[model samples]
Target: MKKSLELLEFLGEPVSRDMKETLAHGSRQFRMSVHMTRVPSINNVVLYSHWHEELELLFLAKGSALFHIGQEKVTVRSGEVVFIPPNLLHSASRLDQEEIVFYAVLVHFNFLSSLENDQIQQQYILPIFMQNRRYPKLITREMDEELHIYPLLEEIRDAYQQESLGYELLVKAKLLEILYRLQKCAIHADADLDIGESRNSNSLQAKKVLAYVQQNYGKRITLADMAQHVNLSPAYFCRFMKKQFDLSPMDFLNEYRIAEAISLMETTDKKMTEIAELTGFCNVNRFTETFKNFYGCTPAYYRKAIRNHAGDGQHAVRCDTDLKSY
Candidate 1:
């Protein structure tokens, strides 16, 4: 029991702070993680747009959240689950109420694959990973199969937390059952799956724009340059970006920069001016104003709050200021 607790503690370390990548060492072994997450009302914009090479399932146990998956926006309330496919850009924001609690189970397709010559890997798993099949992104308690699958999710979570002898085997079995059910549903609804080609094209273009911003956030970036990079006029580019992310290009850029600034504040003891410049705010005063506007507190106050809570090992910010608009 002591050994199990120690292992759980080791696995709880925060490996990924940025939105661009998720680094889970345990997931590399079994390619799966079942974890609980809480988003305070003040710090509601829990994650920025990011993509990973793992299938993600989110169960909302309490409260609500708005999720942006590619160009589609979904409002997932309590007693709901959302599935995000691998390599899809997604972000989440809390609803305008109390804190939100959710369970996230991330599974990489490689976890289920055997040797290269294995029939299961070649026939069933590879096609799902290759996007040859489509699965419903959201499943609510009202759905017909929820009674069958929700219990499996709970069992998996319980088996994971208990970590008894053969716990891993039990969890894997539950996951396989969930995937089989999802695949069966997908096959039945194959004819109704219509992810238009235009949406796909827009997603690709948005990814290009995101890459540009990520690479050049520290430097001066202009709307004209961004539009030219994607072969669109500036006016049209603004429309395209707003449609894709619900934020104009500049709004998204500022949000990304602020997110980077917050990361620096949490990880480093650098001066606010230095952090501002590094994150592309250019002017210290402007950075403070923008930070306060988005976070509902000055950067100095945020840093101090974080320092005071350092011993507790909890996040300092509790409320999200600008996320409600999205």
Candidate 2:
């Protein structure tokens, strides 16, 4: 917890919540990126929910979290890794007073394929990306005794940070190594999983909440509107959201909106006021205050710093050690 809080304080706050489903984690060529996500327990802040097309591995280095993955709550403790398949709604936060820190690595499967189809590709790789087999949901420290993939994940983090020439080659090789271990893990652990179980109605409602926010985030949405979309009374809806995400409906919406605003600031030359309106904030002042509240700094300064570090391939600015895997 000391190291986790230090990293959070180093960055002033967690990396601007990239809660959009469509944002690519890294460049298209590499299609792999790592984010040191730290979720503070204060201010009611949590990692907001979103889905993407890239496979995700979250190595929980310190503290534990009650993770909302695909409508179910999973308690991931220290030294465990979370394997989230593409297109699953997932979010995380500290279950108690402690802060949570983890490394989120996203990689598109196509980038990892061989130049030509091979037997290894067919037998070991194709089933995962093609959805024929489900990815394992969790990898515990105890289960990794034989595989040692946790240490490999730490190696991946070190290799990615080196940035030496041809380091991508090492990263790719390690990712494939992890995949092989994951295959073995599936046979051992997920064999008893009920793949065809019916999803809860609450999960369906959660999906609806995500869908509504994604489509309507740029509009003036309210608590009543959010509750109505899920067809629950305002009071019940708030409780449902709290139980599921530990956040109010408007807080979730605001996190989503702020994520969008950060995207716009990075990708566009839009003015602050325009970006505010584009992100569904009623006024620029409100947008600025909320942005500052989330990140302890003004939007203008954040944008200026971003521009200052342009073309360096930074998703967010940090020192190399700030991205510790364990």
Candidate 3:
């Protein structure tokens, strides 16, 4: 029997608090999360650019969106799947419609190799984790439709939703199949692999700057400080950051701070003034204006909406959902 959409959880919350380092996937046992998400409009950007340790598979079920991966931007239309390796910075924005729907499956590589000396770990997992092999970043239905990867994704989704007896075992088997197929495809498409070597130096520098920001977002940080941290001139750093993240250094900093403020608002009961000070905003007015601009609501209103929705037993705001105990 086909499960109704209402039975599938819809996750549209903001980015995770530790998104700069790793996305918390809401459980330690399974180390995976599956979500069906909807973006109501092009202006509604669901998640900011962030990176994590989990491998991500995103399937575009409807509409179109621009996916920014490192220095590249690709338009992911319906029926396409994008594969993101662990710890790569990426984000998505609506392209041409009032709404876009997508399904995401995030899995820690360790989940696929439960035993320390598992054969899968030796053959498939270690190469990618040890940086000895590379995989393609995006897989379009137009190109890979004949490959049957999309069908496997559908199977995984249905099995996850159905939650039949031994569903975890079924999901693990499907995930292994997907990984094997991806490895085969990557081997055949070696020339087209979007490997990390191309952006090795830049990625390191971006990580450095991001780390500095993560540690010092509460303090007044200057462009010169960040540039010096990355050993680039301010002008060069600006261009490099723009090329890497499609946002200026200051813009990225503000966005990061805003993300932190949103986390504070959702999880803590701190006053707006305190939240502002803690998130590095100068005053309540500036914080309110910036919050409204990014989230389309004042801090107070956003809090109220969250509170009202909190009592609803059917749904909860979560960065990631674990399917092991569902």
Candidate 4:
């Protein structure tokens, strides 16, 4: 338990909440960074959630892993990949013993000052992330064939190892190439996914409730509030939530609250007491107990572990290593 807490402290700290810092491996001026990390065991990580301010591209280079994005969970094995957007709570866990190997790149959409044009940013990036409310967030590869991201991964690996002059420039170019390929892949996969699927009208009420909760999680949200949002009575909404989401309304509310708490914990430097109140918990004791129940550690310890594990560099923000497989 202590070991897991330590790992979570390092990897699960939210990136956006507190004193936002740019990841150091890449040019801070560019709005993204890339790195490779290794862990001795999965328990050395924490099962917490966080989001980024830039688009995230995670390609499984080896082994298998599970990703939790909102209420949706998906598995990605070697040769598989996933896309996560800025400011969505998410986390990953290694699936098996062979150390999980993957290449990840965080891209700040309007990163370059030269490329901050509104039209280009909206055209190239907004379309991918803005329309995410209707679907469970995060994009995963659905095809059986492996995405040839490994070659690009290899190039990045080489540049890191060789460290010849201009290596960073080379890495930046390679990263862009990977993002372009991923964007193309996302458009293709999305088109295919839509063909066989019809909208789930039965879940319309649940969807509305989810959107409302996400928007208002930091405030005191009650069952009455959510029920009214979906035009259902509180009594029926309780049953409906159970039938649809496998959780009671209160449980769902707690999940959202804790999820928000986890994100704030990682990204911001706010004290645990303040975070507890900010995330809608009326009291610190109640908040601490609930947080530990969901995340398997006390909030203070969790924060401490993160500070301890992350190294002395600016960009060395660690990845989640302590979580059980989702």
Candidate 5:
């Protein structure tokens, strides 16, 4: 069963002040807490999706992770870093190892709002967010080879740890360096890729449509109804989604429903009937049937299995669609 949109919204709120403070005391400034994580098995990294209004960067320092960024899923190896846009849905998990070590930086846009020069606004933000430019929006091209910036990342970490004499200024300087480096590489590398002709229009549309679905998942959404949200014809939306994700709109909705159901099952004790209705499914019987079909087990069994293994650590799961757990 899926959680109601209202409940999902509540669950997605940012970390509590107390929790944030707990993470802030150490060398890591909780601007966004940085962690070094290791899991005996990656299964604990259960697949779930959620979007945040803050930008996040994940750098694989010593292991590999399978990451789903929008409609694409790929393995990111050590030395590679991925930058995620604010409000984009993504999920990831380690592919192997008794443990994997990586560095993560979560940057709230407001933290850098003062640095938003006219040039940045003109070139990056407007074209992608406002004009809806249908492109990958590269942040770090040839990321596998960009090890020189590792020093800047380390500096940010150290400045937070030391907090001695103008540390805040130093941190900001390092952040600016990181951003400038990414922007410079993106511009040059994308030029070589010549993204004009080969860009995936359908995937771009799918992203927009998925955002709409997530915002309205608790409501009665249909194919024709969602198509109107993107101003694309119903038939076109259906065809485009199928080509882009290999699933029809309805199939995607079902996957989303199941994903939400999994989140609720793990986090709440709502009854199956209630979850079914909240997720937009009409009956528990139908919900169970669909859940079984997709996961090869009943929801109850799945929940119990997860409970038994909940303490192992955070392991990412296969992202059914883009909607993720916050």
Candidate 6:
């Protein structure tokens, strides 16, 4: 039996307080899970740079986004899927004003190789799993017609949404099918594997800067402090951040702080003042003012709404959705 019911975590709740994803997606027996991530129109930074040790499959369920993965950027449209290999620094921003909604399936390679099934693992899984082979970054409906990729992704979504018995097996089967098709596609596809040195350097710098923000967001952190920590002058840092993230350094800091505060509101019973202080606001009024600026609602109202409708929010409109422990 595949016992895969873990905490249902959406992107609103950061897996950890840091830049890196720290949530355990699934149980130890089966290291895979799915999440519905939503980005509101007012969100300045749709997502902060974060990396985890799991292979991620992202299905654009509703709207489009400008996805920054490592050094390269991909504009992913609705009804598309993006394959993100493990340990890649990635972020997203709304392409237009509409909110971006997507479902992310986080899986570990060990789950595929865990059962040994050695021949397939050695021949097919190892190279791609090790990032030795090139793979397609974007898959469209055309690829689905040709390779049936989208159908499998839909099956994964259906399995996760319904969460019936044997859903784990269903998800695993679809993921393995997708991986096999990806390997074959790479063998014949003229995909570019060279992500470039500039991209690699940018990814490192992004990680460093974002991690610094995560570590020190509770304390008063200045632009000069962040720039100096990353060894770039304040002016250079501002330009770099604007070019890379499409947001000013100060705006990004506030966005990140608000995201953390949102998580606290969703997961904890802390008072608004305590939450604000914990997230680095000078006072409760300041926190509420900024929160309204970012989310378009008072902290108290937002907290009440999220708490009241969390089980049936935009992310969980389906009745069979297993939002256990949400």
Candidate of highest lDDT = 6
Per-model TM values vs. the true structure? 0.80, 0.61, 0.72, 0.50, 0.61, 0.72
Error of 5 at 9 (Å): 13
Clashing pairs in model 5, backbone N/Cα/C closer than 3 A: 44-315, 45-315, 45-316, 46-315, 46-317, 47-317, 49-324, 49-325, 50-324
TM-score of 5: 0.61
Better of 2 and 3 by lDDT: 3
Q: Rate the local accuracy (lDDT) of all candidates.
A: 0.72, 0.71, 0.71, 0.58, 0.56, 0.73
Model 1: how far is 185 from its true place, Å? 4.2
Candidate 1 structure quality by residue, lDDT tens digits, 144-191: 354366778878777776677898899888888887777656753245
Better model by TM-score: candidate 1 vs candidate 4: 1
lDDT of 5 by residue, 208-249 (tens): 766676666667788988788778898988887765555688
Residue 103's lDDT in candidate 1: 77
Cα deviation at 20, candidate 6, in Å, is: 2.6
Of 4 and 6, the candidate ranking higher by TM-score: 6
Q: Looking at model 2, which ten-residue stretch has the lowest summed lDDT?
A: 8-17
Instruction: List pairs with backbone clashes in candidate 3.
Output: none
Ranking by TM-score: 1, 3, 6, 2, 5, 4
Error of 5 at 90 (Å): 5.0
So what's the TM-score on candidate 2? Answer: 0.61
